[model samples]
Target: MTTRAFCLEPEQLDWCARLRTLAAERFRPLAEHGADGRLNRPLLAALGTERGLLDRVFPPDGTAASALDLCLLRESLAHGCTEAETALALQGLGGSPLAQFGTAGQRERWLPGIAGGRTVVGFALSEPGAGSDAAALELAATPDGGGGWRLTGTKTWISNAPYADVYTVFARTGEAAGARGVTAFLVPGDRAGLTGEPLEMLSPHPIGTLRFDEVPVTAADVLGEPGAGFGVAMRTLNLFRPSVGAFAVGMAQSALEAALAHADRRTAFGGRLRDMQSVAHQLAEMATRTEAARLLVHAAAAAYDRGDDGIARRAAMAKLLATETAQYVVDTAVQIHGATALQRGHPLEHLYREVRAPRIYEGATEVQRSIIAKELYR
Candidate 1:
C-alpha cells in the first residue's frame, strides 16, 4: 500500500510514515465499519489501546511535542480513518484540561484510563445558545453545602458524549455573564441526574446533548482556578485548533487523490478526463489549494510547538483556511467524479460530510475570521 508523502522535517516525516503504516494495518479495516453508526464502542477502545495511538501523541507526563509532529499524526490518522481520528481527538481534548490543570489525584485517576483507551473522554462546552459565543454559557454550577456543587442546565452538540466515561464540562459560577464567570468541572458519566441522548446527523459520530439537573460534583472535579474555565477552554482550543486544520488537510488530500485517479482513468470525448483543459484546471486548483492549506496548518502547528505567543492568531488563520479550502477541494472532487461520488458508500461522500464538521466545530470559519481580524487590529 503506497501512502502519500507530506513535506515535513525528518523526524516528523518518519513519525508520519510509521503512523500511516499503523493506520493501514489497523485503522483502515475499521473505518467503514465504524462509520455504520452502530457505535462500536468496544472495538474503538481496543484499537486505541492496542496501538497506543492515543497515548503516544498525548502523553500525560507533560512531555512536549512539536506542533508539526502532532499535525502529522492527526493528518495521517484522518486520511485512513475518520472514526479513529475522531476517537483519538476526543480523548486528547476531553482529557487536556485535566492534564493542564487538574489536581495530582485527578490526573492520576483519569489520565491512565484515557491513555490506555479503557475509558473514553469528552469536552462539553458548547451549549444550545453558546456555540460560537462560548461566553454565553447558561449552565449553572452552584456550590452545595457539603463543599461539592450541584450542576444544572444543558450542553448540546457534545461530541463523544454518548460513549464517553468522563467529560470536561463548563458552567456558570459567577453572576457576571459571559466568559468571565464560567468554571470547568470534570463530570463522571455514571453520576445521578445526568443524561444524554444520541443525536443523528449527516456525519456518523457519537454526538449528543447532556442534561444535568442537580448533578452533584465534588471539589476534586474542578479543573484549574475557579472562574478560569473560559481561559482553560481557550487554551485547549489553541492547542487543538491546528489539529482541526490537519483534519481538513487530510480530507483535502484524499479528495485530490481521488480526483487525480479519476481524471487519469475516466474517458471523456475520446480521451482521458485529464486531457480536458477544464478537468486539468480543476485538478490543478485542487492540488494547489490543498498544498497551500497544508503549509498554513503545519506552519501554525510549528509556531505553537515553538511556544510562540502569537499562536492563537496563527492557529485561527490556519483553521479558517484549511477548513474552507477542504470544503472546496472535496466539492470539486465530487464534481470531477460526476455521479460516482454521490453513491452512498463512496469514499468521496464520506469525505464530504467529514470535511463539513470541522468548519462548524472548534470554531466556525466566521468565528475564526473574527478572531484573526481582532488579533490583526490589536
Candidate 2:
C-alpha cells in the first residue's frame, strides 16, 4: 500500500499519500457540506486554495500535463475523494480548449477563474440527438455576416452547465456533413439568450441542459480553425480518456481496500470472511482485474504522452477496461459488506452511484469497441 502505483518513485508515492490524507481530512468535509447534485462553491474554493492541486490543473507555465501526469493526479485524488478529483478533472476538461487554443483575451478572462477554482467551466458539445455520434451534432450557428454568429440550439447533459463562467461550445457552422460543419466557440455564461437548468442525474456534480436562443458570438470567440472544431474536441477527449481510466482505477482500488478490510474482520461460519475460499477467490479476482486495468490505463496514458500513433485506439482500450473493472470491483465490495454498504450515506453506496456513469459517459463501452475495431482495420 505504501508503494506508489505503477512502480512510481518514492516521492511520487508520498505525494499521492499526502493527497489521500488531504481528501479524507479536508476535502471530505467540504464535499459533505455541499448540496447534492449541485455546484459546491466552497469546495471549489478549497480546491483553488490548495496550491499543490491547483497547480496540477493549471501549471505555472500555463500549459497542461502529459497524459501520464494527469492520470497520476486524478488517480491519487480519486483515491481520497472522488468529488475533489472530479472537480479538478472538470476544470481541466472545460478549460483545456481555452488553455490550448483561446485568444489571449479569452484566456486572460477565464483561465484565472478556472485555475483559482472560482469559476466553473463547461464543455458544451453533446446535443439531445447527438452524443457518442458527436460529428452529427446539430446545434446551429448561423452566420450574422458581420463577423459574428447567432447560436440557436440546445446542448444537453453538459457538466457544470448552468453555473459555469464560460463554455467551450461546439456548434455547426457549415452545411458540410458530419464533423466538417462544426466549430468551437468560447461562449461566456452571461451571454444574451443563454440559459440552463440543472438535470437530476444518477451521478452527482453540476450537470445540466443548456439553451442557446440566438446566443451571440463574434469571430473573437472562435477557438480554432473555423470548421475544424471537431478535431479540437477529439484532441481534448483523447487527452482526458486515459485520466478517466485512472479515475476508475482509483475507485477500484478504493473498493478493493474496503472489501479486504471487511473480509478480514467479518466472521462467517466460524471463520473470518477472508478465510472462506469463495470470499478469498472473489477478492483475488477483484485485485487482479484492478491491477490489470491500472496497467492498461498507464500504458494508454504513456502512449498519449509520447504522442504515439494509434492513440485513439489506446485511449479507448484504457477507458473501456478500467471503467468496466471498476463497476465489478465496487459491486463486489458492496456485496461483501452486505446491507450496510447499501445505506445512502455509506461510502460503497456513493461509489456504487459514481461507478455506473463512467461506463456511459465520455464514450460508451460499445463506442470504445467501435473505435478499436476501426483502428484494427485501418
Candidate 3:
C-alpha cells in the first residue's frame, strides 16, 4: 500500500526532510541571484521542475486541492530558501481565484502557463487608501454601457505586480458600502490602459503599484458573481493565511537550530555556551515556542483542508502567533550569536530582514487579531 504523502501527522517527516535538502542545495543558490525583488524567472523555472511543485499550485483538471500540502511545501521551502517559497506562494495566491471561479475560457488560457511556471501572476487589491482596511478600496470599474467595464484607479503594494503576466484584480463596481460594492477581474499584463512601477520596500518581494486608466474588460473577465468579489477574495485568503504562519514557523525553526548548534560548539568562559544556565534557558524557550507555533500552524492548515467552519479564527490565531514568534526567535538568535550574526552575508542577517515583512503583509498582525476577535464574538 502507498503512504499518504501529504498527511498532517508525523509520517510526513521524510517528505519534509527531502524538501529541506532541495531548498538548501538547489533553490537557495538560485534564490541568491534573484537580484533584489525582480521576477526571478530562471529560479522559478528551476523550482517548477523540481519535485513537481508547480503542478500542485495549478493542478490538473480533476485533482482535489489540499491545503495541508500547500502549508507543508511553504514551511519546508522557507526553512532554507525563503525567496523561492514566497515565489511559489504568490503563484498559488494569484491563480486561485480563477482556479475556483474563472470562466472556462479564462482557466484554459492561464492555468497551463501558471503550472509550467512560465507565467508570473500578481494579486492586485490593496490601494494607497485601503492598506489594512480593504473594504475601503476605491479602484473603479465603471460599466461601459454595454456588457463590460472600464477600469480606472490605482493599486499599491501589490505582490508580483507590473512584471506579472496576469493579475487577479479587485475593483469597485457597485455603489453599496464596504465590501459589497467590489468585483474581481482577470486582467492580462498587455492590456492597453494598465501600467505599473515597482516600489522600493524593506522586503525583497516583487511588490509595486498598478494604474488602470480606463482599461477595458468584458463580461468574460469577471471572476465569480460580479458584485460578490469580496467573498471570493476572503475565501482565497482563508486558505492561504494559515500557510503564511507555516512559513513563519519554518523560519523560527531554522533560527532555533542555528542557535542550538552555536551553543554546543562555541566555548565561553572556559566552557561551551550550552553550559551556561541563562543561555541554556533561552535556547529552551526558543525551541519550546517554535514547536508550539508549528503545531498551531499545522492544526490551522488541517482545519482548512477539512473545510471546518472555524477556520477564520484558527487561521488568524495561527498567523498571529507564528509570525510574532518568528520575530522574537530570530531576534533572540541574533542576540545569542553576538555581533557576527549582523554581518551582511550571514544567514541570520537575511532572516532578520525576511521575518519582519510577513507580520505586515497578507493581513497584518493587528488585522489578524481583529479577525479573531470578530469571529469569537460572532
Candidate 1 local Cα displacement, residue 131, angstroms: 0.7
Using TM-score as the yardstick, the better of models 1 and 2 is: 2
Candidate 3 residue-pair clash tally: 0
**Candidate 3 Cα RMSD (Å):** 2.8
Find the 10 residues in a row with the least total lDDT in model 3: 2-11
Ranking by TM-score: 2, 3, 1
Q: Give lDDT per model, in order.
A: 0.84, 0.89, 0.89
Off by over 4 Å in 1: 1-7
Of the candidates numbered 1 and 3, which has the greater TM-score value? 3
**Across residues 226-253, which tens digit of lDDT does each residue of candidate 1 receive?**
7889999999999889989998898898
